[model samples]
Target: MVIPTTSISTDSLTSLASPSPTLDFYDSPEPAFSFLVQRIDSLLDCSSAQKTHHQRRLPSLTSFVRQVYVKCRLSPAILVIALIYIQRLQHELPIDSKGDYDTPHKVFLAAIILACKFNDDSKSRVQSIYQCVSVVYTNIDVNEMERSFLGVVNYDLYVDIKQLCQFIQEHPTLELNWED
Candidate 1:
């Protein structure tokens, strides 16, 4: 699969691999389009992703993502990295009942949280992010979700520049908007 857009090239993503606050791509300004949400919706639909049972109805993926996008100050790069992490976790799983571990919200939340921490150098940034997410998931729930995510990937958090480009190339339809 190839990305149809010329704007978001491998070179752009390579630069964003070590994003800084000064870069326009590092901080998410409110999106005018819901591109990431649409891509992720299709991803979960196509992959071996699962959801948990709860008394109350879970929030829609779009809403969940939007809230996280703004509240967590997430960029397209961070969300793309989260997608990479989620796909890696899915690939590592058994594709059976044992793999059906958590709800998509929890999984998504965990991925975003992990991405936030991994992308940023500040402990305060991640801690503040955790506080924002803990309102939806208890601190314990978030911790377990994080641990499960890490364990599935065998504590391998690194996504090299080549590998990241490869992942984007493989899932070209999920083209991230690199421009503001």
Candidate 2:
């Protein structure tokens, strides 16, 4: 449950998190990754001060999630599951005339936390998972987010393996270049 001290440069972060723009999920990680990144980037106002804030600016959601995955030593399938959770949540709470209740970091972290619990053989403690996510979320925030996520998904944590396989088979690129 310890995070390594080695700092991952933002440049390296981009490479790690970069999914192909053409990525079709039928789709899985690609849609979720793009959705999260797009939501976050829209908030950054990156054009305001390009040079000064360039180095110290907060990392993109994609990069941060990549860091969490690496730091927590989570399997790639955790990400896939998290994305599925997100899709289900969207289905439950459609972003329409109703407000956007899903805060970017909280939702993303909660999805990953749930994914870990659902997919991992050795379950990760909430506190330990918080260690990797504390930069963007507090412990209480994580707790609330987990609750919110469970509510959104209707507490249905089970993933259908046949459906997942079919999805991968339908979208060969997701299976082939999942690392992207």
C-alpha TM-score for every candidate: 0.65, 0.61
Worst 10 residues of 2 by lDDT: 7-16
Expressed as tens digits, the lDDT of each residue in 21-42 for candidate 1 is 2213322333412544544343
Candidate 1 clash figure, as a count: 0
List per-candidate RMSD values in Å. Answer: 7.7, 10.5
TM-score computed on alpha carbons, candidate 2: 0.61
Q: Write one digit per residue (lDDT tens) for candidate 2, span 90-155.
A: 667644423232355556788878876665433454456788766555688788889977987799
Per model, how many backbone clashes are there? Answer: 0, 1
In candidate 2 the C-alpha lDDT for residue 117 amounts to: 67
In order, the Cα lDDT scores of the candidates are: 0.57, 0.54
Off-target runs (Cα >4 Å) in candidate 2 are: 1-58, 97-102, 125-127, 173-180
